[model samples]
Target: MKIRRWQFAAIILTIIWLFVRGVPLDPQVIFGELLLGFILAIFVTWGFRRMYEGQTNLSHGARVLPYALVYVGTFLRELIVGNVDVAYRVLWPSMPIEPVTVYMPLRVERPTAITTIANSISLTPGTLSMDYDDEANALYVHTINGRDPASIVAPIRRWEDLAIVIFGEEADPSDPAPDIQIGGDIDGE
Candidate 1:
């Protein structure tokens, strides 16, 4: 039987993950460890294929490598900025916490992409992904400073744009701007 594209991708990813996890390639390495890695790779690949269903076309050749690098760099930058922002709020005597929940409609349709975006939002400081309205295709995010919804959403939109390309999802030209609704303040009545 021939290996599918996703399977190949999975194998590559698995090998990379193993290397990153510090699995040595020395000849003295145990055979069992290698066997385990292969098994784990197969399992992960199978699960990915099942989860993505018809959306596992990550065979974009070398084009995807740069996008992947960009995504990681962008994510790291956001993470650092978020940490610093949260640290400032924590250290400041007068905590300026004007919390508000905003409903931002989803543009990326792929489940993995949507999940990644949600996780990224939650990972960022001052923002918490509370709920995902699948029916409405929206995400409810609670932010420490929501006075400017556009500003809050701008970065997320940037991430989404990158994710669209990274995940190989088609960008719908007709797609309207995300419907952002400023929910009531989360501080108090």
Candidate 2:
């Protein structure tokens, strides 16, 4: 009777994909695209069913739009800043690059949130997410400039803060922010 969250997500994603693919707005073309989208939505929903299980219901209700907008805006800004920083380091040979591996603790408990944050980090230009330790809830990140572990993790913490709200994760007031441990210089210095 009622469509599940995964099914809804699949349907929306399919429609977006079709639109991006330049499906025309003519009645006949629209009908055909809708039919195709319906078929693909079914398969996509089935394939990703497990992933939706146990996920936070944050995306289901009224707060979804605002949270999505905030997350997207913050991510875009960070992505741009990271790109420019990397570009500057590359273009200016005199720029000091203190590459270091940082162990960043995780506050979000949801698997989806954790994975999203990790992927976001890797997507940024100056940082690479090397690995995640589930047991420790820590992420190993390598950054071009990591002289101050806190500075390196500050943006990630901001991302995590937004993700907590977007993903409906409970923030623990008593739990201190994750500590960043610099492992060593990337150049073997």
Candidate 3:
């Protein structure tokens, strides 16, 4: 209470609230929306702050902005590319489709980081997040064409790196990613 964690939360939450409101181009409208978000975020952060207790640093939200933005851009690019690749495979018929599942160990131990990475995998075409082994902090990802596990895991590792920063997880992004294991069964193949 003395450090006013709520102030930091309010600032970060206000930015998120404004974003969720679809930032308008008009100056007056933008100011109005920001004012409303500021008020709401204060209540929300203060009211719900009990859930955020025990975190090592509650003030890292602003520092996370750049990494979060980069993660979004990277995810978006992979989404578009995956969609095109999947569409081409669907249309061409002869395109290679060697489905395979891989187990990827993660440096990010937090649920938020793991879930973000898992969801990103599922959202991208030709890949699905079948399961997560929480004990190991790893994901089971199935890719349509995974002859090369490295290729399938490259973007995911990128996202994980960003998520570690965004979530303020204990892991260091500079640390090498764990070795991936080819795993699971895709139609018994």
By lDDT, the best candidate is: 3
Measured by TM-score, the strongest candidate is 2
Over the full model, what C-alpha lDDT does candidate 3 score relative to the true structure?
0.85
**Model 1 CA deviation exceeding 4 Å by range:** 1-6, 9-13, 23-36, 43-58, 172-176, 185-189
RMSD of each: 4.5, 4.0, 3.7
User: What is the alpha-carbon lDDT of model 1 when measured against the actual structure?
Assistant: 0.76
Ranking of predictions according to lDDT? 3, 2, 1
lDDT of 3 at 169: 81
Candidate 1 lDDT at 106 equals 79
Q: Model 3: clashing residue pairs? A: none
Residue 90, model 3: lDDT of 94
Instruction: List residue ranges in candidate 3 displaced over 4 A.
Output: 1-13, 42-47, 54-59, 62-64, 184-189
* Residue-wise C-alpha lDDT for candidate 3, range 1-189, written one tens digit per residue: 234666667887888877899987999988998899999888888798886664345457667878989999999999999999999999999999998889888899888788899999999999999998877877889999877778889999999999988988878999989987885542244
For 1-189, candidate 2 gives per-residue lDDT tens digits of: 345678777778778868776987788988888888888887987898886664334335456578668777888998999999989998998999988888887889898889999999999998999998888888989989967777678778888887787677888524578666777532244
lDDT of each: 0.76, 0.80, 0.85
* Selected candidate, larger lDDT, 1 vs 2: 2
| Superior candidate under TM-score, 2 versus 3 | 2
**Candidate 1 on 20-68: residue-level lDDT in tens?**
6686666556455556777887787787776534433345645677866
State how far residue 185 of model 1 sits from its true place (Å).
Answer: 9.9
